[model samples]
Target: ARKGVAKSEQYEIRREEEEMRSQMSCHSLKKRAVLTTDSGNCTAEEASESEAENSSMDEGDDEEGSHEESEVEVLDEKGFRRTQEKKISNVKQTELKAVEDEEDDDVENLLKEEEEFEEKIDFSADTAGALKWKEDLTQKAAQVFLRQQQSTPNLRKLIYGTVVEDEDRE
Candidate 1:
């Protein structure tokens, strides 16, 4: 009795495993069939999708056409000569907008660079201030040099320009 019960349980488990394997294989085959099937030329869904894509593509062209038509109507009311003037100003507006954006970018960059340079200058000045003796000595040396150059005519001439003889001076 015990052996028979064990055998039945093993058989039930094997059957269930086989059923699951077959169900998976069937599902995979159905998926393969759907992918491989070709119903013929374009279906209604495909045609609709293609039409939607084309309509979207044409939308930009339609916008351009409408703008041109409006311009033509306006020009008809204004006159032909005015059309040329309007076009010239229209073109200038686009060009000027681009130029203004470029100038804004350039100005922004210039201001950033100026801020960075000021930071470096401030840092160097702070460091120089921290060294009181060194800063004073440098200043004194520059002043002494300037005075010596000013007091000596020969030295001043050599430092500045050619020494004028009396005729050249006149």
Candidate 2:
């Protein structure tokens, strides 16, 4: 019985660690969305569109790997969003400052690129794919949650480790 208990404790600890890692990665994606998306409200519509796009591409993938094209587009959108966010941050800081003529031209060029990128974004297929991706992520997150709940001892230890002994005792 003692050996069984010890083994279970070790398993709990490992599960807790996995859950922690999953939560961190999940929140990192949320943080990226918060930083890149203008408002948190659009996330729902964005997800819906992504799922619709995924549905459309599902049939196409059976053919000559045409669905990979949508996959590439999805990846490109993510990259573009990240890059645009960085450029926007830089532009925001300099908007109120006097800039060199060269800097002004560069900013204009960046703005034009941003506009073109936005115009190229297709909501139909991308939305469906995004929704599918989100559902998969959420499902994984739910599994992590269940694992955390089942390994409550490790969770309690983790929480208590951060608290003062006096507070924890109470």
Candidate 3:
């Protein structure tokens, strides 16, 4: 019991450290940066469209080996939303020293890429006059997809009904 409690405590510490790292990385975006996307609000139709896209992609894609990163959007403290690709690498490979080195390099490269993206989105100077909202469509889609998933409690009500949910409620 003592060993088990110690292990669980260590696991929680690790989780908190990872959360802090994610927060720092996500918050690095500049406030004054004029993001290319002007996404005002997410709607039901938009959510459905994202669901359809996700469903179709799920059906046709069984080759999980080919995909390394899955896109997810994290909202910062300032409510600035930016899309990031979350690495879903296999845990079996975690022991590899080469993979560790590669991941370190990848983190550095990812930071550089984010900086470049922020720079690209900043159109505060003005020049072409035509604003490009099309560039961040995929990011918008990812956000919509996340929104739908986050509403899973509503889905639970529809599927399991209030009866089952009520019994489980604290």
Name the best candidate (by lDDT): 2
Best by TM-score: 2
- Order of all candidates by lDDT, from best down to worst? 2, 1, 3
Which segments of candidate 1 are over 4 A away from where they belong?
A: 38-170
* Tens digit of per-residue lDDT, candidate 3, span 1-170: 99999999988988897797555434432211224321211121122123222333343342232121111122132322232221112211221322355555564454445434542332221112222344454555456445655666576677887787776543
Q: TM-score for each prediction?
A: 0.24, 0.25, 0.22
Q: What is the C-alpha lDDT of each candidate?
A: 0.42, 0.49, 0.37
Count of clashing residue pairs in every prediction: 0, 13, 0
Indicate the TM-score of model 1. 0.24
Candidate 2: stretches off by over 4 Å: 38-170
Worst 10 residues of 1 by lDDT: 39-48
- Over 32-140, each residue of candidate 2 has an lDDT whose tens digit, in order, gives 4544332222332233233223333333332223234335545676676564455344343444243444565666566556544553554443555344454554556
Q: Write down the lDDT that model 1 would get.
A: 0.42
Question: Any idea how many clashes model 3 has?
Answer: 0
Clashing pairs in 3: none
State the lDDT at 100 in candidate 1.
54
